[model samples]
Target: MDKYTGKRLDGRYEIHELIGSGGMALVYRAYDEIDDRTVAIKILKDEFLGNEEFIRRFKNESKAIAVLSHPNIVKVYDVSFGDRIQYIVEEYIDGITLKEYLDQQKEVKWKEAIHFTIQILRALQHAHEKGIVHRDIKPQNIMLLQDGTIKVTDFGIARFSRSETRTMTDKAIGSVHYIAPEQARGDLTDEKADIYSVGVMLYEMITGQLPFEADSAVSVAIMQLQADPKPPKEINPNIPDGLEEITLKAMQKNPVQRYQSAAEMLRDIEEFRRNPSIRFQYKYFIDEKPTKYIDAINTVKGTEQPVYNDNYEYEEEPVRNPKKKKKSTASLVITGIAAAFLIVAVGFGLAALLHSCSSGPQDVPLPNFVGHNYDDVKNNPAYKNFKFITETKNDSSQKAGTILGQNPKAGTVVKSNSDVTLTINAGGKMVTIPDLTNKTQDEAVSNLQQLNLTYDVLPVEDANVTKGYVQNTDPPAGTQVAEGSKVSVYVSTGSGGEKVAVPAIIDETLDAAKKDIAAAGLTVGKITTKDDTGKPKDTVIETTPLPGVQVAKGSSVSIVVSSGNKSEKSIDIFVHLPKNVTHDINLKAYLGNELQTEKTVNPSYNDVCQLTFTGTSGKKQLTIQLDGNKYQVYTLDFDAGTFKQDESYPYTENSSASESVSGPITPAD
Candidate 1:
């Protein structure tokens, strides 16, 4: 690795020092002599280069990203092989590893975690747009730049990602803490897997602990494949409930259950930040056994025991005392005492047994379930032995406690040998309602306010629903809640979601135009260069559909910019014109265009101009051309009386240019 360091690599990049070492390769900080920038060079370990499969996968993913020039993703600079060194050059980012940052902080602040998560989402969203998925998303592969932006790296280096460009197939066992369930199960990993991994990372960030841990890597991996760790709230109850829900949703064990895309994750995080009380979680029991719960209840219910005194034997009157044997009077006295003792013992025992039963059942044991809901776990007849009142309410928002509502609550005494009933908290009922009326839009959403109602603010075209007025409800007004309830209120979504037309970007520099395009929800595509149109070539000049046209979200617009260059040779120029037309041609043309003109070519009035052309007396060809290529040919029988005043040329059509060529030609004016 050092041999290539400090020298030109691939005859262009000047190798520098060893930056880091990964499982498959060693990275070096290098300088691109041609591009004149620092880059991270990753060279496959010498031994692994021999493995053709690994070599293929390594090259394919790298190439996948080389074309992905996204703001949040590390840019792949170049890829090449020489001297048994298969190296990939990427954008050199100066920053700390997300893992290192997490380790140093030990616990990321909620705001910081959210901000970091947002960056990751943006990166993933960008990847998804390009049809790529970063399967191994983890803290180690993320870098927090000095300026605090997160750069998602190492995506193109995963072994399990089966991107079409992958070159190798290896037994892929990802890091235990970050591997998604599907990957563990040897299922095809996709965007969902990456979403799960990000969720795990966020969990670790806020809780300062991995969701699951075991003695061996394999064990941890297995747990991830099959189990969910205790909810984030359990680890750090201080974490906002909303954030926990987002985390759980992201880490859902089933791919179908997890977030489908990074954009969705971003939306959830934003929602959670807005309201942390809403968390998504499910309960699970230890070893998934029903008996574990029944046994727990035994201690409280005391029903499993057939009888407390069954093991004891009652032996009445042990043949008086030795003294009684000598004296018949002593025997009589011992009998009287024994009879009294028996009477007292029997009376107290019977009374106590009756009291215990009358006081209600004993408290039942707490069933061990981490993420289940009440209705789901309730009614296991095994719980009948405990003495506890059951209360089940709509708490769809909360993971149902295995013993939904336990008597003795968590730890209380049951009337020994009694029956207990538990009322569990059920997840809230689902509903769709009419609009909220008269109340402020914000205040109108009484649906989810815990009165067995949950209402969402619906967007409607209206002048109503001012801050306090209810627009409308699903079930009209006065609908009952807590049972079969759902309401939607149309709030005054005033002046929102208005579409904006993409502006002309042809002549503007790439950087300047990119910012505007992205802000408008438009993407830049196919950047190439052509010789100057006399404007600052390569600069944006014009875009499609003119400007100010209202369009929907994520519209694709093309920018025709100046190349800021001039063709070295004057090639065949063709004039594209209507055939068999002769008229006064006052063609004031421009051969070389300017950048300012191109940038605002169609910006407004006075920005349009013609290309350079000459209306000379050339009877030989009588042809006009533009751009020196893509030409049109015509035979003009110029019968104009005046050279300057006469625009009409007695142009007769030549059969045409080469039949193979399909282009327009006309008289040169």
Candidate 2:
């Protein structure tokens, strides 16, 4: 048996059994005696009690969870630090980790993936806004309930975002496969790092595979640093293009290129949820520079050669005469003057040609084309000299083929035949609304998103349909609605029955109370029994919401039952002091061999110290000891508040002393 299975901590929480174990802690399913409810206690592992690093992480987890209170985030109820143990009490979640769910179903549907991702993002969004960053985020840290709710868990490594000088260890901290590049590289991390992990999880959910995986964690970390995975659509063609874009965009290698915050990523996700087919024109900038290639021959010493011109021919001549040199100089001067005149004449002719081309046509003013059709503008005789470039976009507010915008504003001067870019509206894409009646809210949402449409959900009390399912949608099924159009979806809020007051069931039999509760349109929830004086055994003592409280028609009502009045009894514990003792001595009392209390007394002033204990009636063993030595043992009948001698021991000094008290010992007030 586990040491703590039957133990009570701080005289309150009773540990039942170990439910989970991690690197630094052990989680137990415990009951809070004070609160009368089940809670999960995460106790630091015995081996880590003395380890400072583990202790810090254990406390960090408690502090991190304590500050966050979101529907999708696990909640911390209490924290305790003791000499031998440290533990945190958190809400007991009855569910499996998302990792287990993924393992059971390797490939999750895209719509289901989005549902989980949205909850995770919301949790992160809340944590980030509070200046906390969950340095570790993965499916293993997410809890999935049966009702399709998600609770993010495990913030052991979370850090405060405002701590500018904080830095992680050189070794990678988070799970290698889902870690961001900056995290893997041991660089400063922020909210964008969590976004990257979410993207990886989305990829795995839709593609049934991790973006980067290798045989070892180090190899995977390396892959995260330098490798790029194939787009999710390649593995799962059913994944929508826009979702793929969002996923890859979040996984960008550069932190700045990824979503700057969880809210930013959530916006993209919401946009995708509204219009799955809506494509995002996300552009990433890459710096590039021109390169010049030089010939290797230009660097070789012996390869250098003199330049030769075909236009001037040279002839070798034997020693030239002085007279001939003078004649040649005069001839060269005359040739240079004639060449300069020829060059001037050519320049003048070229300038005259350029002026004629520049004056061929006057600059034309750009005409307004925002409201005109592209075809009419393209074929207009007056604008025939201009070159038109067209781009099409879907716009519900404009007619098909209508020009929506132009490059230059109207009245601007532009050269004739210059390029003019026009943005033309291609008309809104019409999509048929799928039948949503009887479908769950999530399913209905997925259907609408697949058609690039938005939805406004209105929850109304419904008698026929189940809660959270779509009752009906406005505009009806089969209607051809334009993309991005809002569809009003009516969601069922369960049966709309009349509210009924809970009747008093105190002091009634358990069976009778259950029947009365059921007749009042309520169901019995958790039933607990406690000792009470006013009620008999098996009688209902009270209800969770109390009597006369209003509740929904079919809501569950928890009742406390009586286990009969407890029999009270008292015991006198006596301890004999040694004559040789001169300093203060301590006397300890035990009931059922468990320490109840201890008292310190000066042995010089008194020889005998007495203590009394009162508790539930039962046959119990009473043991009293002095200075860590066994003194006496007795069988106490707590029902009769009496006792009989079981065993006795003499003082070590060989002195005779009374081991049993003749009368009841009065407990100190």
lDDT of each: 0.57, 0.74
Tens-place lDDT per residue, model 2, 549-652, is 55677888888888787756555654556776777655566777577767676778987676677876777877765545456676666654545556556543
The parts of candidate 1 lying over 4 Å away from their true place are 82-84, 156-171, 275-669
**What's the CA RMSD for each of the models?**
32.1, 31.6
Number of colliding residue pairs in model 2: 0
How well does model 2 score by local distance difference test? 0.74
Error of 2 at 476 (Å): 64
TM-score of each: 0.41, 0.44
Model 2 Cα shift for residue 320 (angstroms)? 71
- The regions of model 2 sitting more than 4 angstroms off are 287-669
